[model samples]
Target: MKKKHMARGTGALVLVTGLAISAIGNPAHAALSGQALVNSKCATCHEAKTDQHWTRIGESRRTPEGWDMTVARMTFAHGVKLSSEERGAVVKYLADTYGLAPDETADHRYIIERTPSVVEHPESKPIGDTCARCHSYGRIAVQRRTEDDWRKLVHFHVGQFPAIEIQAGGRDRNWFEIATGDVAKELGKVYGYDTASWKQWQAQKHADASGVWRLVGNRPGVGAYEGKATIARTGDDRYSVAMVMRYENGSEESAKGSAIVYTGHEWRATLKQGGRDIHQVFSLGANGAELNGRWFEANNDAVGGTMRAVRADKGVPASVLSVQPAMVRAGMRTTLAINGVGLNGEVNLGRGVKVIKLVEQSAERIVAEVEVAKDVASSSRDVQVGRASGAGLLKLYKQIDYVKVLPQHPMARVGGNGGSQPKVPAQLEAIAWAAGPDGKPGTADDIRLGAVPAAWSVDNLNKMAAEMQDTKFAGRIEQTGLFVPNGAGPNAERKYKTNNAGELKVTATVKDGSRMVKASAPLIVTVQRFNDPPIR
Candidate 1:
């Protein structure tokens, strides 16, 4: 066996042992390549033993964030010292080499994009009981491992948590046996390390990201935005992003950022908008023709929204993705911004809606002032931009009979009193609802009139919360429907002297005509989430 000594901290050294293998996968120039760093640094820990691949690591695969957390665990738990650049390289190398296929992660994209308030329930109960009962089902679903590796993982969990079997669900049966016998096999079958999909991915050609792209999405507090993004290749798999966003309110803003693409399709970027930092987690579409995911605030992950982009290069199909000011109040002249690709032609807002004026025109966007007739029925309208038609893109509403808060309930944490985890704020939106043909709000035919401005407030959730005065201590809701949690700690004065956690309810009041429509949702502000892995 060849021994390699690696220095950690100041004087300590870790001894690495590995036998010579017939073949080795070479990591390229480290400064320009992540594989190189993996060979020079990570090789000391994960020995190359099986079939010229690293031992335990070679048989396992994960998403970029999963690999990132694994590397971060080394830095935090093993006292391994790595510069941020070096760490990123290692993660990139591992993820690219042993990354999951695009379809493998398709079902769990919400967690990858840091989407707020996602509740995932896997189809299998044994898998759920054995693994997901502790963490997110997505964490297990997006990962690949061999049957032996799965068993080894189960053992490791028991070794670390000790009484995990008893603590996980009910201790009615042989939990350990079930985990090793049934759960491991099921996990291996569902998330096999060597699959036909991975083989196809390995042989497929990935598209370059440098080019022009059409973009559209709705930001919660702000209205819908239509724009274009230009990406230029700065280095291998790295891009410099420049974007021009035209909000429906006739306001425009530009942003620039840096991004690194992992595993070909996984695109992660960090950008600043109006001087506030934001992050983008997107999946490049098949053939690099499009991308979809979410962009979020750097300081607060919950305070962001969804975005989708399509390659607008030459010969691309004309497609209409979204329309700005989607909700046109009856009897109002609203300028609708139609955003998409290859945009050109007469703008149609269905019957009873006339395009009185064309404000602006471009290949990516068309702005037109349209007047909605006062007698127009409340229903979803199809928008036709030139040859591209988007069904249900426009919603014309005559009245808002009710308002419903997006994310009816969500879990938040109290933090920032010198705690490691930052507070998880909840951003809510009050969406107006029309009775539609059903003449009732909760029916399947109800038409959503999009988001409307609302007054935000919080109240005690229940009798226990009211008795404890939880609303007085929990947090404050901004006029924009953003809930900023109070600092974490045990209070000195109060009943029972507890932490600032609270059971609360959030209310969004929308003023429609003279009647006030209010919608309330549950909000549980409690102790910090014990773990928030990238997959979770």
Candidate 2:
């Protein structure tokens, strides 16, 4: 008996796509001779023996036209060497065994599925793998195109990837015609290409804001002094800034930076500067300021300098020579939120501040300046008791009171000081935090004032949480007060209410998973009720 030439099916033919097959003849007894005959001559070039040799197309049974196309593909694309007689014989054998039945849907599907995959087709890779890396491959394949349009993408890729080799030389314009026409032919056969639909797709994907640069801050304002910036997705990953800085005397100087920013939800830019090609990373925070990184000398030692990104759109004017802000107190942290293209040069806060610690928030950094708030405290004598006289603001700055960040939910007070009389309450409404000399808010030295309304802002909460990074709600001020006033004066009496006050017993409960942490503070809301004169 002739050795069974039961050649296994080629894997290239059988993709993950499960194609249905109709049984033609009994393979157990049919033609072992046909396999041997083809192998002796065709195997030398066809390379397909068992499953391994089957071209991606061969797995499907196709019509005569399809078979003819495959033969062309193998011979022309693969350089398959076959004599005319041998090729005729192989075609005859394949047709007799696997010819499509006229009405079978399987035959049609097989024909369709036999179209080349991206790897098998050279043109598909540029659109499929390269373009698809950042976006969808459908984005490119669906575009309606002229030969020129197709060539543009080809040229673009060749330019960007550099490793990509296009058939066209720098000046050879005709190469587009050849490449696009070939691609169009293949696509027409495979997807039944519709030019109109393709053009619509291209228009949608290709048309975007080009050449325009955007400067987006986390939120609004120009720099860190006003309020901390709130970063978003776009500015987190990419930051583009264009600015023409006008000097104190009104002379313009240009500053531009196009950077790839890793926002990580905060704003920080890794920038490449001109001339020296130096790379620097700048971190920004809320308000009207910024902090810059060290300058690396071209392949040499780096010297660090403070960079205060002054929001030129607002703030008081200063000398043009100073790019950094005036530091008021040694340790005062500041942040900036920049949103426009033009900024004033004098907005940098450079008077008497020293950066003590820096905290990163998304793309910006919170530059903490070190200054003692005690040195800057206005009152040296016996402090009066009231809600004004700058005493309330000072208490809030000193973090002597605890404020409820979530104003909607007031802390439930129990047994401490519960009375309708004008007296100090057992609990306060908000929490206050210490302020550095530069006037930047710091974390609370300790939880003191219980539950006050003034400490409900996100900024205050973040400061109260400090480096621990534990706070998640946004709040608004409901009330403001100072149990200890700055000074006593006739004008301050009405403004600072030193008379009837109500006391509160405040209880705070913070839950961490299954564990609960609780604390309490005494609060007083002063009210002027009596006009009785005091007799000495």
TM-scores, in order shown?
0.88, 0.17
Clashing pairs in 1: none
Candidate 2 residue runs with Cα over 4 Å from true position: 1-236, 243-253, 263-274, 283-301, 308-536
* Candidate 2 lDDT by residue in tens digits, 417-493: 23221221111223322343344434433322222223212222333333222111111212232122111112223
Q: lDDT score of model 2?
A: 0.29
Which candidate should be chosen as best, given lDDT against the real structure?
Answer: 1
Write the residue-wise lDDT of candidate 1 on 76-119 in tens digits. 65676666656666666667778877887888888777778877
* Per-candidate alpha-carbon RMSD to the true structure: 6.4, 30.6
Badly placed stretches (over 4 Å) of model 1 are: 1-33, 36-52, 74-83, 168-173
Shift of residue 162 alpha carbon in model 1, Å: 1.5
* Model 1 lowest lDDT segment of ten: 8-17
In model 2, how large is the Cα lDDT of residue 466?
A: 32
Model 1 accuracy (lDDT, Cα): 0.78
